[model samples]
Target: MTAISLPSAMEFIWLEADLLDSHDYAAWLALWTATGHYIIPTERDAEDYAAVLNVVYDDQEMREARVKRLQSGLSMSASPAARTVRTVSRFRAMDGAAGVFVVRCAQHIVEYKYDRTRMLAADVLFWLVPAASGISLQRKVVTLINGDDALHGIGYLL
Candidate 1:
């Protein structure tokens, strides 16, 4: 049985970040398990995400729809998606349920569009399950540093 090392987990995270930064949504989507959820909570300390209002809480179907919308030319916010560069670091890993790994990290993103640049920082957590190929994301939660504040133009994947 192959074990998940910190370095390997971090590598996967970096790959995911790269995919998002490049707007390679299709490849990014392939990183998840069929039941995976992508979440961005409205509250920084939110525990039960399902009970609280969230900025994004997408399952497989919703994720697919979101990707389509971003790729389509219709949605105003997504029409010209903001260009983004993301840095992810400060990784910590621990075993969760049997055959599951939980990883936590810090992520900072710089987005530029319309000649303006904005920064976004967040604490990110991931639940990973080993797959035949390598590892698959079971859940991803991103809690923004200023989740409660008024924010705009986050049309691209973070």
Candidate 2:
């Protein structure tokens, strides 16, 4: 097996962020392998694999369904869609068994409407599986800093 370089891993992360920031949902979904998981935790201490209080959990099918909903104009809240800006910082990498690695980063997302603005800060953990097509996401786990408070709606991608 070939080793995954840090630069390549960072590139994949940058690409993923660009796709999300651009609202290219279909392109974003295509980046995931079939068994990929997306998670946003409601509790900081909760393990993503075992947690029940997730804000969003999606396997491939569920992700596809979400994309379909967005594309079909079924998402009512998208009207005058919320604007979002995200900055990812402080990237750290942890070596996993075999060829996989876990990348951790701090993310700050600012979302706004006409008069309402909300800021979300989170620690994001990504399982990076080295593939022929570069690094594919095995899992994405987000732990919000403000998990205790009621979050305003996230109508767009973070």
Best by lDDT: 1
TM-score for each prediction? 0.95, 0.90
Q: Tell me how far the alpha carbon of residue 118 in candidate 1 is from the true structure, in angstroms, after superposition.
A: 0.3
Candidate 2: clashing residue pairs, number: 0
Error of 2 at 114 (Å): 2.1
**Per-residue C-alpha lDDT of model 1 across residues 1-158, encoded as one tens digit per residue:** 47777888899999999998888999998999999999999888767888889999999999999999999889988878888899999999865787778999999999999999999999999998888778899999998998889888589988
* lDDT scores in order: 0.90, 0.78
In angstroms, give how far residue 87 of model 2 lies from its true place.
0.9
Candidate 2 residue spans exceeding 4 A from truth: 48-51
Clashes of each: 0, 0
Supply the TM-score for candidate 2.
0.90
Predicted candidate 2 versus true structure: per-residue lDDT over 58-153, tens digit per residue: 888988887776667667676556777788878888767666788888889888887988899988888888777766788888888886569876
Candidate 1 versus the native: TM-score?
A: 0.95
Q: After superposition, how far is residue 15 of candidate 1 from its true place, in Å?
A: 0.5
